[model samples]
Target chain A: MRARDVVITGLGTAVAGAGGPETLLRGPVAGGDDPVTRLRGPGLRYKDRATRLALCAARDALADAGLPEALDAPEGTEGGGGPLVDGLRFGVVVSTNWGNVDTVCETSATIHRAGYTATSPMLLPNTASNVTASWVAITHGLRGANVTLCNGPTSGLDAVHWARTLIAAGRLDHALVIGVEPVNEPVRRLVGTGGPGLFDGAVSLVAEAAPAAAARGARPLARVGPYARRADPDAAVAAVRADEPAAPARWYVPEGRPAGGDTGPAGLPAHDLSLRWGRSSGALGVLQCVAGTAELARTGQAAALASAGGEGDDGAAALLLLAATAAGAGA
Target chain B: MNVLVTGMGAVSSVGGDARATFAALAQGRSGLAELRGFDRSRFRARHAYEIDDRPAPGTDVPLRATGWLLRAVAEALADAGLAGDLTGVPVLVGTTLRELRSVELNWCEGAPFDAARLHFGTALRERFGADRTYTVANACSASLYALGLGTDLLETGEADTVVVAGVDTITESTYGLLDRVYREAPESVRPFDRGRRGMLQGDGAAAVVLRRGPGAPAGARAYATVRGVGLNCDAYHPSAPDSGSIGRVMREAHRRAGIKPADVDLVLLHGTGTPLNDEAEARALGEVFAGVPRPPRMTAVKSMIGHTAGASGLHSLITAVQALHSGRVPPTLGLDEPIDEVAGFRLAREPVTERGMSLAQVDSFGFGGLNAVAVVEKVS
Candidate 1:
């Protein structure tokens, strides 16, 4: 099967912002107020914070994509079957470094302190990294290929890579890609010192095949292009440049580093979402991608995302290029 | 894209390697035993399938889980006849709990923290020197996801040879979580049996060396070809299996493999001995094979090896490959009386022989509604 062009059709954010994507692209979102606490659903009271955050972000992403609320039926629908997207064809891919770490820690602590019987069955499912993806699928009725990538900070990049691959393979027409992390005690402890920049948030984007986006009259946010991972940064940049010689107009690099010399177009305006959003580990890359897509949507230019330190000291790196599409013009 | 399984290795309770594990399965020996691998004084259900024949502690790696993975990788490499250094081979390891036990113990002891020692991906890269290493933590079906991802890596021209592994140690956290989640039966894990209790946790690791070809060289054998992969979520519940989704995934796998349900010769089930899962899976099998003239035979390995969590998928895949290679289906252990609803599908109560094997399916479903199915065929 020939590979089709994969485009981002929608965007949503639950990271430190109550107003969704706009608030995320703007400044801070009301002092890091958790969007999960505000989420409401059946049996949601028992769900952990991370699952709630993921669901809320998915809901917002579907709405942003002009799709109906996945969980809610339209007023005049019969048998409650009016959904904007095909549930079986729609998919979800989520990335998280320490998924529901707080729940795991607390559940283990409960068993240690109060005994095994005291551990809640409700909390057991959240212990796995894939549960957030599961909740998104279950709550939103996305029955297509569901996957969770846990490669630390670069996981979002991998998730996006896999999502596009699935769409290209014609397995799924659309995929909801999410990167989420919540500020929990365990994460704080693991990160050490309760780090100053550590924060919690979720980022979600709806990636669709070109034909599907065009048929739905959906506005394409950006055209995904040239994704590769390399052990050497020089090779990674070179590969990206070779794929698209124009070199991205904007860049998202690792925090605190001056972007130049093999990283991207020299002296092009660069931004670091990790620094502003606080290190969310797996969610960092998605935040960066969303920032880039937003930049492309806003400025009619392409953006490049690069990350160093793939597998500890292995010198592994990844570079992803996103160019603005005509449909995403003047957003 | 032809994905060849050139070599297979396993560090499981049934055996220290794939050969021994296959032998034990053929002999109908069970590996479920009382938990002695860790301190289990506070727990009510102490039985688990922990690897008893462990190599002595090594200085090069810190975590015992990593050691198991290294052993499996070495065996896989040697089995594949790959000599010299594998410096640039891509490695992907999947686990439900990625060194969380180390973190929990170290935190309890208030010891100095080193994330590399506990991070599975970093640990494997540091030990094996792979060019790229990734960790997949999608609960029980994670290794299947890794298998698909590894196959994708090969098909997409990322690497020629890829090492895919799945390992999870029986940690206190995992045990505690299971203990709270279900009622444990220490005597045995009996899937599809009327008197069955819940599943018993297991610890193990498996590695499969995959190459982008139809078969391997002389003397070195190719076990099977990964013909098709289909992974999806239940999208119904967090910990419960959805019958519709299960059937959909199986049909998808068959569709991708260019076969109908009737073409499947055998099935490796994710029969975890839980009532909810067993019934759901049975209904799914019935649904998918409803119109088939000859439904496939199904067997559960967890009944013998216990549920190995993330490693369960690869472990069962190795077993399925062995079945295809030997032309004999291993019996579903402890299934005294099979559940009537799925009886028409034919559970392998005893070792069954076949003249020649072709295609089989291995199913793995996880806690978070994560489901993966792979259709593998004996290289013709």
Candidate 2:
């Protein structure tokens, strides 16, 4: 089978105070609104916060991709059945660091305080590490390849890369990629509250085969480009540049590292979403990709580079995003 | 490009390494024993398949799973002739409850632990000097997903060598949850049995060194070539296995491997012994191999090792690879009265030793219907 070109067609954000992708481009805002209220149907009582956040972001991404009818059907409806694309061909890849910590901690604490009898059976399913990703797939009727990555620092980019790999391998024509982190009491206890910037939200995008996107008449937000991983940021950038030489007009750097300061390519106008939205850990890379998409939308025909991993990380990853027009013109 | 399994390692209740574990399976040795990791008096199900070799005190690795993972990876690397050096190789670790036992210990027993150890990347990097690490948490099927991802990495030239591993230590929280979910805890796990009660948790860690076939070091023997892996979500129920989807994924695996169902010689089942799961899997198998002239012989290693959760997939895969190499099909221990759903398929009640077996398929279905199936061909 021939390799397929992957493209980003839809973007969504469920970050607190950030209404949508446009708001995220400006800067992060602080608010206390409940992200669960954004959900469309019942069964929210048993879901954990992270799952609820992922569902909201998934809904927004599917709707943005012109598949609003693809979700929110009553439970037991096979494949979110509607007059749209086949849910079987649409998969989901979620990246989360502290995703189900609340449920895990709470359940374990209950068992510790009382006995095994004290825990709720309804909550048992949430203890599975892939609970958040499963919920998103269940709600949206996405029956394709479902994967949840908890890889450190580079997980968000890894999730996106996995989605692209799935599409390129003919496993799925479209994939819903999500990066989520919730900052509840459990997370605070797990990671400690010493850090000033703690992320608490979800970011999602729809990655589809270019041919599929065109067949569905979906407008491509950006073309998924070359991705490379190396021991450090400099080598990662150079590796990706070797694959695609187009100079990026903007750069989204990794967490705790300043843009263009010892990290990323020197002299490129870099943006760090962590400064605005707090350190998102695993979610930072996807958030950076979201920010890059927004930047490409603002500046017509341009390229954006998003790099993740730094100190305490195993390695660094660099991903390139080309504007739809630029990609079409073979830039 | 082919993804060949050049080396393998495993540590489970039955054995300390892959060959030992395979021997135990061939001898029909059961690992289920009285739970000793925690206070068993509080729960009805007092048995688990805990590893015999406990991590020594004051070990640099804080978590038991981490230690087991390091051991498994070291054995695999050495088996692949890459011992003491993992400079440019990428490591992918899959788990359901990574370091959660540490969290539970800290929360309940007031044990000290660093929070950063929750993810395995740092520990793996510091220990083996791996260039990159990815930790996948797709519930029980995580390791197979990681295997699939690693195969893609090699196929796409992302890495010359990749280590795919899975590890999990039994945790009180999971035990409690399972105890509550099961109405009555059976004395032993009996996969595909009519009177099967449910599954018991286990401790295990397994790893496989996958190298691009063309780039493999000279004189390195390949155990098996990973033909393909198919992954999918049921998107139906969180705990229930969907037979249709299971059949679809199996067919998908066959399609990706460019083989027919009849070509497969053996099947390593997920077979958790839960009534619903066994029945569902049987129905899916019946459907998938309905047209095959001679359906593959099926066996459930979980019947012997207990469900290792995240590590179960790799454990089953390693067992399958070993079976293909040795031409021995391990028995699904304690399967007294087979379920009616698997009427046509051959369920091994005793170890079957036969040569010339060329292909095998491994099935791992996790919680939330996260399913993965892999096709492996013996490298002669």
- Using TM-score as the measure, the top candidate is 2
RMSD of each: 3.5, 2.9
Best by DockQ: 2
- Per-residue lDDT of model 2, residues B1-380, tens digit only: 88889999999999999999999998899899987776665677888888855455222223888888999999998998886567668788889988888877776666787766787876787888776778889898989988887887787777889999999988788888888888898778999998899999889999999988854679678988999999889999888889999999999889989999989999999999998899888998888888888888889999999999888999999999999888888999998888899777788789889788889999999888899999999887
Angstrom error at residue A264, model 2 = 6.5
Docking band of candidate 2? medium
List clashing residue pairs in candidate 1: none
Candidate 1 per-residue lDDT, tens place, A162-271, comes to 78877876678899999887777777777653333775778898988877777667887787776665565556556666757555776666543454333344565555
True-vs-predicted CA distance for residue B321, candidate 1, Å = 1.0
Per-residue lDDT of candidate 1, residues B1-380 (tens digit)? 68899889998888999899988886778898887754465567778887754444211122768778888888898998886246668788878877766666554445455654444666565556565667778889989878877887777676788899998876666677777777654467888998788888777899999998755755577888888888777778888888888888888888878888888888999999888899998898888889888787788999888988889999989988988878778888888888886777778778777757688899999976778899999875
Proportion of true inter-chain contacts also present in candidate 1: 0.53
lDDT of each: 0.75, 0.84
